[model samples]
Target: MAPQKAAQEFVGHKLLDREGNNVGRIEQIYFDDRTDKPTWVSVQTGMLGRRHSLVPLQGARVNEGDLMVPFDKERIKDAPDLDVDRHLSVEEENRLYRHYGVQVPGPRRGMQDQGDAQGRHAAGAAEETGMAGRATGEHGTDTRAANARAMNAEAADARTAEADTRSGRGRADAMADEDITMVRSEEQAHVGVESRESGRAHVRKSVDTEHFEQDVPVSHEEIHVERVPLTDEDRATAGNAQIGEEDEEIILHAERAVVAKETKPVEKVRISKEKVTDVQHVEGELRKEHVEVDREADHLTEDDYRGRRRPPAG
Candidate 1:
């Protein structure tokens, strides 16, 4: 049998999961009718002890000054909800035991039974709750601690097996005496996003000569002397007019290319994002575990696993 602790020794003790995650704290303790020892604890689970749950106190320990449970948080959160304010019936107790997979204490043919006080663990959570806890069992005890340690180890092993199964890495070696080593490989893919200028263009100017020819009529001064029969009017003007003592000059004009500079928008390349769906052909070698049975191993009768050797989980 495990050591017994006073009802006050349990109140306000922090409850921790196997992975050291805080589930809650003990708000009350429920004693067994026959043993008069704490059989169940009312755990105030949510923030500030707002929610309550009843957990079996069997095989539990104040290991290293903390109450470490064998199960995880999700399991405790999903346990059957029981109100600690009301009486805990024999039916309720049996259900709790079954839910926790605990073998209910069998009937002792000649054991004495005690009457329960109010049959509940707590009156109200807000009631004053903590006390200085001292060990109640025999001092210098080792058997119960060893049993609890074994139970904890079994529970941890079961959890690890379950996790391995879920992660698709079932145990390579299941035999107790067999040595095994598992090698696993994983591939990581990284994708990134950013905006940058792939190419750039701007309005720029540079001068270059080209053969640009066009039919353009231009006027220029040219010296031309033509002899023609004098008309009556030209003769009369030449005879009446005197020779002018002045210099004669002519001006020449020709077409030339003229350049001008101005700014104007001709085309635009607006930047925007469009979500496009495309398949990326990522190639890599994947590894899978291949179970191979040794062909040359000698066959021998193995011990039958009775499943009773595992200690009761806390």
Candidate 2:
């Protein structure tokens, strides 16, 4: 039995599923009316935070610190899904005991036999409201903390198993005898501690997060300029044009060469030496005149004698 004040604190307190690891938190406690003691606890499980189940608190042990729960995380996870109402029922409690393979110590009896305030059956009004918020039994045991721990452990274990399976490995090596070191954040731990409270448990805690900043090189490749070949028509036209130009140039050069070869320049010729000849004239006229005069001398001598006679007379 918890202390009175502690009991008040623990009324909304949690119970965890550590043995048959299941993710859940304690909703409320279902006490046995016959013994005026708490029996099984109702736990809400699953991701949506729905699906309430009842787990027998028989062999379920609590830790000294009222913090951690020691149990086989995996087994609890695989346990049967519990209905909220039936688990609170006597018959439902029997079914869970049988399913879990646990022995029920108490004799089989109906809830109505128990006395007032401690009856197995709740008040008529509580009964009418259905199982939504049925408060039965004297000690209101809050299993919220225990349930949170169990659920957390179950979730952690499941994640670990999944990770292990993904890595193609078997069950994880045992972390510690009390708590399996699957993984849990300090915030989660805080939440687990306060999950039993009526309000939300918002405990400030620090976590070591490995942040990665990597520089991935993005390379831009050099693009080359492509040169497309000329078409057939263009090639033919260019070839013809080149050939015509080359032929014209060749003909022009040939004509210029022939003209240059045919042209001749005049050159002066030099004479080496010249010779001069002189002719002599002979005088033989006096002899011929004297001969010619001899004939006439006779006639002249008569004429001269007549003239000399005339000059002598003058």
Candidate 3:
């Protein structure tokens, strides 16, 4: 793995964990005061980028266009809430340290080493006093006194060191216990509609009769047998003609009105809905305190005595 670039180049870069999970984008970068190196980053998260989170930049480096961190997405997002618009306060820094369980480098670390050396010297001096005090009783008394003095000094230093640690921890706890009261009030509106009969509609259907006409073709036949032809030629051909039996045949066809029924669709009916908007006046009452001032009470005393200010009547 290569070392990451500076914050300027790391800006606008996405942050991902070792498992390639997206944490957020680097919205800001904060540099440590002593080292002057970027150690914290503000990430823009949540929907619409409305939420911003602070995350440690330890083990984070720019890989290509993204910044990779060795922390989880949720851990970074749930870090201590501190605004990065200005320098980080001591209380806020301590809070972040406590959240990560990282020990703060004490300014008096060398003092602890000095205290250890002093304790060792005191122990060696007491050992020498014990070895020497085994001789003359009077000298033993003085050496024993010196031994007790060194032992007391070592105990006092130990107590001082312990008190300092407790006091530092107490201050952090006090800051964490600072109380904040937030009062929020809001009004909600309710919109409702009920089903009611607005109006009525009626549909009536009727049938009216009218005259209709049509033409139909009919067929008939007229038959005539000629007797005059026989009468005129009967006298002239009576001598040369002898009549025998004759036969005649006819074929007739007649047409009447043909009637058949047929069905067809003309009109249909149904119910439909349409959306409409309307404004209605709403009425309600609210409770509020109204103050009344009287000029006659201008001379009223501002304070009242707590003990025996007035006697209650029976």
Candidate 4:
């Protein structure tokens, strides 16, 4: 496809180099004055896309909806820097052609030839008019002088118009060069939560010992002898018994305390985790960009121009 058509189709799309590396995005396209074909293009580059670079459109192609040029990223970045004010001067265009080692188009040379031809034609017409005036004598001489004056006036008017056009173009160029852009940026605070091992807890069991005490009652047998009161009954009961040397025996018993141990579960115990949310007040020093404009005029102070306006007191 033609370079001009390709440029129109893929404008605002990514520009890739021959090695498949991204150069930038195509922002603007330029065309040749005589041929009306795409000659150069401006690509937006740099960190913030604040910078633009010009690259030649020769040997350019479109692939996969992107404009690809036969140049590397470094070569395009290091190309000549020129003003992109909707037109390119002959000198500026020639410089680019030379830098890229491309042959200058033949149409520009044809334009120079056409100009020389016009100049020669005008010179020949003047010579023929002078010869005609000489042949007609004084009458033709006055006519010739009048014609010369008219031609001179026309030429002067043309020069004045040309100068005015050039002056306006100069002012426009100055304005284009003076255009500046400032970008203001600031830091933002982004807070997030992360899980870490702050501390730990454990549930365990251990055995312990204690002492107990209590009181109890007991009974035992006792023997006693009396003299006068039981004499007749005791004597009668003892008369049936024979006196003998014999031993008496008896059994005695008492209560005692006993202790034993048994195992049983009193309560269930286990480890668990839960989330508790709370807000924390965080503070830090943030850096930011502030823009100040300075204007030079006949009667205005820096404070008056740069400072904020305040309301008057009542």
The most accurate candidate by lDDT is: 4
Candidate 1 at residue 138, lDDT?
A: 51
Distance from true location, Cα of 29 in model 1, Å: 1.1
Strongest candidate by TM-score:
4
Return the lDDT, model 4, position 111. Answer: 75
Task: Report the C-alpha lDDT of model 2 over 120-150, residue by residue, as the tens digit.
Answer: 3346434443332232222365354445456
**If both were scored by TM-score, which would come out higher, candidate 2 or candidate 3?**
3
Candidate 2 local accuracy as lDDT?
Answer: 0.50
Expressed as tens digits, the lDDT of each residue in 1-314 for candidate 3 is 22235475777878897677887777877876655667677888655565677776667766667988777777666575567688786677668767755565453334667998999988986786665566336664666666666776797799899999999999999899877555554433344555669987677778887777889786766676676445666677677655799787787656678867686888887767786888888776534445554556444454554334677879
Model 3: runs farther than 4 Å from truth? 1-5, 101-314
- In model 1, which residue pairs have backbone atoms overlapping below 3 Å? none
Best-first order by TM-score: 4, 3, 1, 2
Q: Compute the lDDT of residue 203 as modeled in candidate 3.
A: 70
Return the lDDT, model 4, position 38.
82
Ranking by lDDT: 4, 3, 1, 2
Give the runs in model 1 whose Cα sits over 4 Å from its true position. 1-7, 108-314
